[model samples]
Target chain A: MQFNKAMILSIGNELLIGKVLNTNAHWLSGELTKMGFIVDSIVIVKDDVSEIASAFLSAIERKVQLVISTGGLGPTFDDKTVEGLARAFSLPLVLNAEALALVREKYSSRGLPLTPERIKMAYLPLGSKPLDNPAGTAPGVYLKYRGVHFFVLPGPPREVEAVFKTSVQPIIEREFQRIDFYEALLTIKGIPESEFAPFVKDAAERYKSVYVKSHPKGVELGSPVLEIHLITFGIENMSQLRSCFEYILMSAKKLGGEIIVLKEPGVKL
Target chain B: MQFNKAMILSIGNELLIGKVLNTNAHWLSGELTKMGFIVDSIVIVKDDVSEIASAFLSAIERKVQLVISTGGLGPTFDDKTVEGLARAFSLPLVLNAEALALVREKYSSRGLPLTPERIKMAYLPLGSKPLDNPAGTAPGVYLKYRGVHFFVLPGPPREVEAVFKTSVQPIIEREFQRIDFYEALLTIKGIPESEFAPFVKDAAERYKSVYVKSHPKGVELGSPVLEIHLITFGIENMSQLRSCFEYILMSAKKLGGEIIVLKEPGVKL
Candidate 1:
């Protein structure tokens, strides 16, 4: 369980001020979940170096195996995520020649000179490797610290996806064998969430292999709509997952609940 | 600075698994920022009680003045936020009579009986006051522990907004004087973000009252477009804020940058 535990840390002033909606965390969590990792926590901190370092340390203290952080990798003054990582491990920031070459190549192709700000992107914490960013100037970072895999990515949504796909995903795939992950959503109407809660609890308890949770969409007592989500891990229990889902649906229908929609398998909402 | 610092905690299994986008944290952060509180950090943890309690303890340890947590206030077995609060403070979970009355009234109006599942929503941590939820059945919890004001809100977005507006907002208003807060975005094209970073750094340094950060919307070296975000606080520095913004725009224009759009004052993002 500890080996497959992951945490996401999003760092930026924009996020702290609520100017950005932290889509990066959500995207990373979904990706990690699909890869069979249980995302333990998602923490957002300001651009301040101490805060970033403290957050990283706390994740390590909690024994989080994979820690992926986004934002503050730019060439601006406010960009301090790399420095924060260095501070966290008490590692020296050194210019990695390979990273410098990558940065140099990107700017030179554009007929641009390598300024100090541009070169700043080459600095990496000791023993950390740089991941090539296919879509951005700043190279993403990959490090192993205190038995935790740390991937530092860029802020923009597009760049996050690009670096993650090219660099982060491969490393994750190599490190962990993919577990069988399954999830399904059942949308029902006519019954309040409270009334449906007991059935969900009973199904979850009886199955022991499935996790069931209900979300109330419509009013409690008036035109009630509930979304029941069921999930399970492990390859041998696929039948158990289906039966658990069916049991809940049947119970709901018995209690005057009408099935509104059942999401197609492998479709995420 | 500590007097006006706040932190947001979003607790749920769905959020951890990326089933939900955590719009509640973003929305709450925006509201808190508008009220002049510097949102220090936003942390999302699983619905597990120990994790929830640990998050609360960390925020208190950081000396955060206000902590608003949304999610896990429902009839389900996974709704352990209130219990987590009690665990963090070593307080007992007591049946809140006022909250029970609120729940009773809502169910009685719908001609529904008070089942144990519905009654579960009425329990609160000792010494906690229940806030009326206008949009949902479960009432929000407001508590003062270790000199930090904690507002425990429900998961659903509509219910969160309703409880926040009807209950949390007034308490915050009464406790703290609203500071004048202003933010503006400057969208520019043609110059790259790395090229524009120094100018932003210079403007931020030259204008001590202003905070300037750049977001690259377009490619780094090809057709670069950067959105410069400027933020400031206080009522007396309005003129300085204007000059600071003008200085950045003037500098950008001088560097072959085209002003694409300037957001109206008081507009966010």
Candidate 2:
């Protein structure tokens, strides 16, 4: 599906404090980009009501079509994303019967008694749909407030990934029309980014929709092993993206650097 | 020093593609927080010229006083951040004599001949100050563009960290006046996030500067632990930040959760 713009709100203290690796943001961005969505901004805020509310306002101000927030949907005191959402949208946090039932069933299947805190997972913004979280206690909240679709996913990556793939993706696909998008990654070894700039610029000029980027790899000490990525979108036909990829690969190969080509939609050349 | 806002621009394709982990963003954010800077937003974009320029514009729109960018300073085709910065600021990209000498000496010390690509590393935005990399071939650039301080470091995590600490920190300290700031973090274990929301709400209401959050430890599948963090921040008198933290910890402890007090500046208890 194609979205005009999206914003990611990664809600967690571990993300801000360096205690945990935040792979969720990167993974989500890639997924959205591949689905033809332009991620306009990403905000990492501690799971605080004010911060989340402020970020929500900022996202709305930016007019992002979608806002996906991860974390702060758990049963602990620190899980304030739901409350933050209520404040942001001026909606009361209410318990949804379907969500409550789902939580009860989830607890029952796990053979655990549902505590008051556990039941709190069912509470969401008023008039919101609860997306089932197959892997965790918290059910994701899918809400559309003031033209922005908000997806509140659990903090656990497994649960977030599952809920996103199963529930959120379908909703998004239904809401937006699918668009043709393509990305090509050219891993060029032994070339520094500076030397690679002119060639990439030439290629980008030649291909209007194509973009080239260079990244360093190997030894965290900044040893120069560079990877170049060429991305194209909105090809009139499938052959267009492929031809762009071919032209980039040929030029990169002719530059005497080892090149590995990767085509979008699951083709590795 | 207290900064209400900062933005990070991670300029690399490896991060966007999941080829390399973006530890630099996390580490830098953590460091900035510790130094009393609130990291409001982070953008990970490819080494595309227009993308970098647009990202800068976004940061400016947000009114983020401190804008730090990592990557695209090397001598390869993808290393166009310097040029991109020039475009963003409407300045010229010129060969800096000092940067050229540093690049020459760096290659000479390693007994490597300076290639055209290597010489490309000497180019910098007009009136930009070069920050020594200490561990990499590319020196970082520190410049003021349109009243915002920009620190451009290499993409490598280690180099970014070192350059930021040695070069950027002192400059920031000198440029911005110190504002009395105090922060405390309280780590809570075993409590589900939803159950803890009331306490978070109560604390936030009572202490306007306090913020609480929860994060699942080992976010991947099969991870066994979860962490809840209560953070309080205030300018000048730390008593408010401290009182809020203590109250939350005491309440959580009374409710039978494990609480670990973390060391913060100027807090005895």
Candidate 3:
């Protein structure tokens, strides 16, 4: 029953307080979409343990195939994402020897002592494996609980990117089978979205499998255009993608509009 | 008791599909936080009506003072945010005279006829007032359901910014009392986050109001710095903020760390 749907949770008070922009969620969602996973929702919450648990549980209850959380994997007291995940699934927080070894090595090589705050990261939820984080000290966490795979990565975007590339990407490629995911952007200029809305709606109805979106570009008066984006999932639905594309292209031609940008249907991540 | 809290919901498939980056949520969250509102959560959902309604209602049930949504206030069929708002509050969709007049004026001024889809933007939730959007055609929507104020602005960042600046900001200032919000970033080089995590945590507990975060900056093998961000909401707690600042300053001095960047606390939006 796994539908290749993913949900993203970003845990940090700095994010909530808007001290940090959530580039991680945007990057992850884009990456996952490229990987053919339908990202259901992206949520940003503070570093509260209960709030984290509730957000996680809601995703779990919705039966998403994967949930990716960034931030709150550091050594500070506010970094309670692991504890939150543990509380969400009722798993005991256990100190893993391997994570501790990595932590010790990282600090020792840096000529620093192993402090309690640093050691706190070594304790993960029971039965979850740690993803090696080459970019930083905190190793990312990975756990598969009842068909849903959860990966908790560090807050730093660089660390999250490195860990996702080295560890999570490989595992995702090996484990999850990706479907045909193609998206095309047909940028039409010199047409108000209202004039082309009917055509877009007709295309959406005709091509039931493809998603049709008309994004209004250029907010200024006198010369705004609509960027009609078309997307379809599943390898067997390439025809649907083409049909929607041609329909929009033809519609643009009839309306005397120019196709400014035509992004082909590959991974645009 | 209405607390100064807000939740942001981004309504668009472009956001969910990662076709467009979510700059709106970040900008609005930062502005709201700077205005002394505690932004609780930021949620991004697709253009589906039920999904939008559910997310909006959850924010309402949480009793947040405000819920702001960006996107889907357009002429396209996928633009379903207004309908979603109507469904969420069990209100009938009513066409407002002023909104239709504005839409007509915008279309006629450009030497274009107002299409049915273009007129659709005039339909708003019952009892909701349309905020004038000088930057674009679709007027922003404002509604007060039960106790929460819901503001739905157009998806384009420029329109959202302009509408907020011209319409929403004044209403917020007039209705919601202001509180002092300050945040400072004290960047220290040559100090591992592990070494300073304790101080940040201690400051958070000591200050009670100020949220202290230690963000590890620079991912290289050497010469990394930790950016300690401290934020306080109330102006009466400046002394507490100063106490936390001095403690961190002294801690960095003990660790032989150099202050790389010190951004003073005066709303760093």
The candidate maximizing DockQ is: 1
Task: Point out the higher-scoring one by TM-score: 2 or 3.
Answer: 3
Clashing pairs in 3: none
lDDT of 3 by residue, B23-126 (tens): 89888988998888999999999888999989989986777999999999888888999999999888999999988988888888877887789889999988
Clashes in model 1: which pairs? Answer: none
TM-score of predicted model 3? 0.97
Better of 1 and 3 by DockQ: 1
lDDT of 2 by residue, B82-115 (tens): 8888888788888888888878787777566677
Better of 2 and 3 by DockQ: 3
lDDT per residue (tens digit) for residues B133-164 in model 1: 99999899999988899999999999999999
Q: Which scores better on lDDT, 2 or 3?
A: 3
lDDT of 1 by residue, A28-122 (tens): 89988888788999999999999999988887898878899999998988899999999999999999998999999999998999999999999
Scored by lDDT, the top model is: 1
A216-249: candidate 2 lDDT, tens digit per residue: 6653123546666666555453455566667756
Please give, for residues A1-269, the per-residue lDDT of candidate 3 as tens digits: 23599999998877776567888988898899888899999999998999999998998777799999999998889889999999999999999999999888888886778889988999999999999999899999999998889999998888999999999999899889976578888788877788888999999999998888888886535676778788887767788888788889999999998787578765454
